[model samples]
Target: MTAPAIRTGRAGPEGGSRRLILDMAARLLRSGGYHQTSLREIAEAVGIRKASLYHHFASKEELVEAVVNDGVRFVDEAVAAALAAAAQAGPRQRLEAAIAAHLAALHGHGDYTSAAIKVFTFGSGPVPESVRLSRRLYEDVWRGLLAELREAGGIAPGRSPEALRLFLLGALNGSIDWYRPERFDIAALSREFAALVAPNGVDAAK
Candidate 1:
């Protein structure tokens, strides 16, 4: 299958300014979550009039949708690359690559990526549909990987891949609350989590 589209800077009239708005929006969303972030704040940070910000996005929800899509696309691409590179590796290695990619994608890609974890919730707003769609898209990718591990007996006998999926995502996503980049990096978390879920205490087949 073709790869997911990786996010890049936009180009057009006032494209640079628009990108700045999105970047600030992402940062505020990451720091304060959905309800706390406001379009006015985003505009002020972008050094544009509120009306000018509206030139790029009609509503706050619209701007947020773009940010969420960008975040999902990034991790989607990162995980795809990790999985592809591990094509010849064992299922355990594949899972390791996936875990590492996930951690790397979450924290290091700025607020666009981190904001995803922070503001990700279903709500009665323009964002709910987009939120669900973006999440399902990313989840489906990881689900495929877990299914393979399940088929190979790389998952525990009593546990299902779906459960593992929830566990892994929940754990990784919660890092926004306390993850200290100075103290721990994605590689370390990846290895630690990989060990935790290593199929009934075994990393791989003997």
Candidate 2:
């Protein structure tokens, strides 16, 4: 995939230098992950001195905090829009719409979304309370979506909504590791994932 363009100068049209830095940091973090990424590397990638990077962000953790939050916000907004657009649809369809929106956001905002998932899931060390809270808010969106499906009897009889949320999210987020648009598409992937909640339930491969 092509790298996100970083506008230069003290005030870039792309939300200025701060935005540029975050974009670059997210891309690097997606590839190197949190532990492997550093302020210096982000600075270099953005074509700025480490000292200049410090002007925008005091520390590496601070920079990552911003990127992680942006990541969640991007997906959150996309799913919200999808749900709103599908308001008249049945609970199952609404849920499927949410899944499709989520997949689109994950792949579309590749750097930010993947960085958020990688930092939270694979980064070694304590995850900040701020990061956890941000994630919880995003999770609540899924909780609400799943609750609607449960209330409408759209979910499989034996599945726990909470467990299903985790399972579905795990599959969706885990796609970052192997999902390739060239080989397959997000729309088909969303349908296959949504099938898990179908009344008959989907059979797992033995």
- Candidate closest to the true structure, highest lDDT: 2
- RMSD of candidate 1 to true structure, Å: 5.2
Tens-digit per-residue lDDT, 68-159, candidate 2: 99998889899999999988887777888999998898888558988899888855788888888988999999999888877777776788
- For candidate 2, the clash count comes to 0
Task: State, as a TM-score between 0 and 1, how close model 2 is to the true structure.
Answer: 0.88
| Local accuracy of candidate 1 as per-residue lDDT tens digits, 153-199 | 77778886788889888898888777888988788788788777764
* lDDT, model 1: 0.78
- In model 2, the clashing pairs are none
TM-score of 1: 0.85
How much is the lDDT of residue 115 in candidate 1? 79
The top-ranked prediction according to TM-score is 2
User: Ten residues in a row with the worst lDDT in model 2?
Assistant: 197-206
